[model samples]
Target chain A: MSTATNKKTVQLSHGGGGKEMNRLIKDIFFNAFDNPILRNEEDAAKLHFNGNTAFTTDSFTVAPLFFAGGDIGKLAIAGTVNDLAMMGAEPQYLSSSFIIEEGFAIDDLKTIVNSMATELKRSGARIVCGDTKVVPKGCADGIFINTSGVGRILNDHISVKNLQQDDVIIVSRDVGRHGAAILMAREGLALESELTSDCATLWPIVEQLIATNVDIHAMRDATRGGISAVLNEWASASNVGIEVNESAIPVCNEVSGLCELYGFEPFDLANEGTFILAVPKTAAEATLQVMKTFCHCEQAAIIGHVNDRKVGKVILNTPWGSSRYLDVPQGELLPRIC
Target chain B: MSTATNKKTVQLSHGGGGKEMNRLIKDIFFNAFDNPILRNEEDAAKLHFNGNTAFTTDSFTVAPLFFAGGDIGKLAIAGTVNDLAMMGAEPQYLSSSFIIEEGFAIDDLKTIVNSMATELKRSGARIVCGDTKVVPKGCADGIFINTSGVGRILNDHISVKNLQQDDVIIVSRDVGRHGAAILMAREGLALESELTSDCATLWPIVEQLIATNVDIHAMRDATRGGISAVLNEWASASNVGIEVNESAIPVCNEVSGLCELYGFEPFDLANEGTFILAVPKTAAEATLQVMKTFCHCEQAAIIGHVNDRKVGKVILNTPWGSSRYLDVPQGELLPRIC
Candidate 1:
């Protein structure tokens, strides 16, 4: 069958561990995140740590375990580690659980497990424990992964409720890479420019930021509902309003073009690699500088500021010099893009 | 369509969090588990603690968001808290994350969340932090949940490596309840005897066990591959073999009959609410007595013993005077049952 015909539907081949799987991981996920640890393509991630313990867990069931920029294996590890990073933690260990569809290819599973081991080693994390279960074929789409991570918290004050007035909001690198990549992968929309999913571990960038000792109030990895959801959450949790300069919010040209063509707002899309930092306004520049030292975050910028007025609200200054309310994206703008 | 006509197919209605959902939770989950925390149907479990912290994480993605015993919400809380309990910890706090499908019903979502809150209260655990993501409809089966728990570790020396030669293996209550329940739910099988999934929290039983001070070496919930898988894991981890007296192993009559007819070994089936304990052979009777104080564990029994011979192996003595090897069930025999 031609690639076009096959492209419209997700087949078991998409999840098969082979050349296609490698292409999917490198071309989409690697291209977007572009970090040394991830690029190394090892079985586990190697990390450095300093303080108290931090733990988090995440599960990925992105339909078509094999997606445009990544697969469930990569997504699972990245997601959990990012949560630890958000806490300014140095990830140390991970426990993975697999819920596989009965009849899932054993070879395919081995491939995924191998990839996970590689990613874990590369990120400086170890798989200390794991659980596997098989459900009847029709009961699951293909495969789902649950990863629980433990990290050493480098900074004790890093928390969602730590934000204060005058804190600046800095976004790491560009937004919408993950959302757009998954969209293109699912819709089969070919563009002159290909968009890759920004699925990656943010520990390195987070580690660098912590080392700088720049005052950070809170940090969140913008995953689902993109920047919009995270900002709203931060505003609500910190009891502060946020105002963003639209032009300062970075978005890759390819992603911007795709979002425009698809009638989706980039702010509402998910981003696996991007993080929002709420820092003391005076420390914002230093934070951005430290973040930029990491290639994945070279384009980091202070896009917004926490304000005293309109607490619990997020406002975006439009390109036309108009301000608009940025609410939590009501539902999924782009599904399964993780 | 008539219910009979819908056989062999699972629909979104199964996960809708309404009457059908209640029936599934009660008839299947509650019947098997039959615990006070679950029967109370409150907003969070009221647990008493004495100085130690407990921690655990569980991620659930049943093809049908809702299942025979419970939805991802209840499963998320129960699964994680149980893990903490197995470690002789008192569950106190929990964190939950949801991967929701874009088109999932808002009402259903609310119900699931509320149910989770209720289960948490019933288990005496609090939902302290959480996250939500929406994946496009086809990108996810429906809704998947990952829950991590923090509890105080009350007892010391509960590690698997603590197992000693001649330690007796005690199982709390009947085996294979959860697996059989899921099978019946999936197959839509009806019989004179009803079998429900034993999906419930075991914190109370575990807490009682710890209080009795019976020289427990290790404890594990018999999930996924069931009692056999857990025993095998214990043996391998502790560098010992487990020899079980077949007649001493407790199996519900209905579950036994179902296993026989389906060509399944009860030992290989999953049981969410059941746990395996390795205690000094001399303390087995006392442990069983403590277990009886918990209503759900009235059928607790001393079924096996840890031995130096056949290290890292699991041996079962049959009623017919034959000995057979019980290996980890290769691959998943039942999917999404947990």
Candidate 2:
């Protein structure tokens, strides 16, 4: 195939581990994600490590490839980095792997890769190594990205089972924006307000919280199953009861409107950038202050508190003075939301 | 869906970040790849590291899922581990991410997970963290797996750019078995002899080579683009010329026969378990003796030598004494052969 034609789309030979593959990698991935370790061009990247490290992985297969606020590339980077940041680690090195359809547009791939490079810069993480595979057109959708990251843990006190009685619960931002955004894109709904997915890297806010040495008992991003999943998991893992004032939880008008239209609970929708935290009541104010400094996390608030009663359960109290169990989502609320 | 039906096949809800997703993960992934690090049930796995490390990643989308010698799960582990091993690192921890098509058989999933567990034992590596995504039916093929690995470097001397003049080039066992085996399986050719893919992990053999303390210049697995690709890379990277005796490279009967029928060069065919090494002529005897101790490397021999005359080129000397340049394999030899 002519080089001009090759530049237009991804062909099978582009992933064939030959000349075409080499040129594509160098021209795109290497050029955008250039770093000393990557330039070595070895099968693996050589790195130095000391002390405790946090490792995590995530795969992004969101439909539409590009959604409001962020695309799959941005999600891939932020998702993995957030996982490490949740553990109070400084996001460092990441390995990206792509599974692309043969006829996918090269322009789109370059856009995605460039987005990834941009996202990596937010937390100073580098794409040190990566792999690419191309399957026949119908064998896969447009593309899927898997990012695995490793970082040195700055604080080792965060754990899923670290909640204690009287610890205050905080939400980093309004929940369900990611799910609402993807749903809107999929359904072709052009709302007047132009709602976007809350997809972003949480490392900046997380780094501040760690730097301030807030006694963070547990921290987790509300991803696939949303805040309900995080609250429910914390209760079960720590064997504590979590009582949340439903009205105190922040939710954007767009997400609440979409949830009502689809008969879905806001707590059940996913959020890419939102997170939940459990900290001693004394540290809750400081944590919220640090989080609110970030533009997207300005809505951070104390929505709940941990207690010993009703162990292993999450209770949601309504504004009407009634309460119900805020159970973990039971069915598929949304697929490929992040 | 009924519980029985749900047990028979994976449902979208199983990856929905809900109770069902929790059960699926605990029942399958956690139960098989059990380890303390994985059991922590956090967004990231906490690990301790010191000194130099090697990191790499790969995504496997091989067709047929299962071949004569191994399945996708085995290939996923072996491939990533080999990348680290080729860098003279002892494979330690791995992160697995799976993108599955909705409605894939649960039985097949179990078999694949079990194979992964079995393969992990071969290199003493743990699946410390993982992610799973399920796409709608027809959005993906059966499944694609991405594995990212981290290991401690056992020897820092091996590198693609470390080859030097008079370095003896060695091949571990036969070339082209993996490509030919996948092709046979794809074509459904019932060859009388079983021609299994050389899909074994290389850590054990590599560990011995390192322990022997034999001087080594560089090493790489003859994977996707095969030995020809490695020779060209080494020559280009180290600014040296590589001259190979074509007849000295081992080629099994089945692979040779299949290559002849398909009009493919053995040097350009992929091999999963086989590898190439560069060592000084003085250390060639010890290197070959150590390699031959393993059954698969019984035919290991010196295939060529590095010289300074023809930098950035690989020349092949045929049995008839005519020399030809064995250029890097330029086209797609086989897709998803890993």
Best by lDDT: 2
Instruction: Give candidate 1 misplaced runs (Cα > 4 Å).
Output: A1-53, A63-70, A103-115, A121-123, A189-191, B1-57, B61-75, B99-115, B133-144, B186-191, B320-323, B326-333
- Put down candidate 2 lDDT per residue, A1-338, tens digits, no spaces: 68787679999888888898999899999999999999999999999999999989998899989988989999999999999999999999999899989889999999999999999999999999999898988999999999999999999999999999999999998989999999999998945557999999999999989889999999999999999999999999999999999999999999999988999999999989999999999999899889989998889999999998799999999999999999999978888776
Question: Per-residue alpha-carbon lDDT of model 2 for B272-327, expressed as tens digits?
Answer: 89999999999999999999999789999999999987999999999998999999
The candidate scoring highest on TM-score is 2
lDDT of 2 at A55: 89
Q: What lDDT tens digits, residue by residue, belong to model 1 across residues B1-338?
A: 46553332223333322223344445433543344433433212222334444444555765445656666677777888887777777776665666655456556766677677667766687654444444444645666777766567777567666678999988888898877776776676734457766778888777777777767798888876678777876777688988998998889988998898899889888777788899997898899888887877888888989888799988999988999988776533654555
Expressed as tens digits, the lDDT of each residue in A1-338 for candidate 1 is 46664444333333222223344444433543345444423212223333356656666766556665667788888888787778777776665656665456555665566666666655687654444444444556567777777666677677776789889999998998887887776777635456777888888777777787877788888877688877887787778899998999999998999889988888878888888989997898789788888877888998989998789989999989999988776523644454
Which 10 consecutive residues of model 1 chain B have the lowest summed lDDT? B40-49
In order of appearance, the predictions have TM-scores of 0.77, 0.99
Q: How many backbone clashes does candidate 1 have?
A: 43
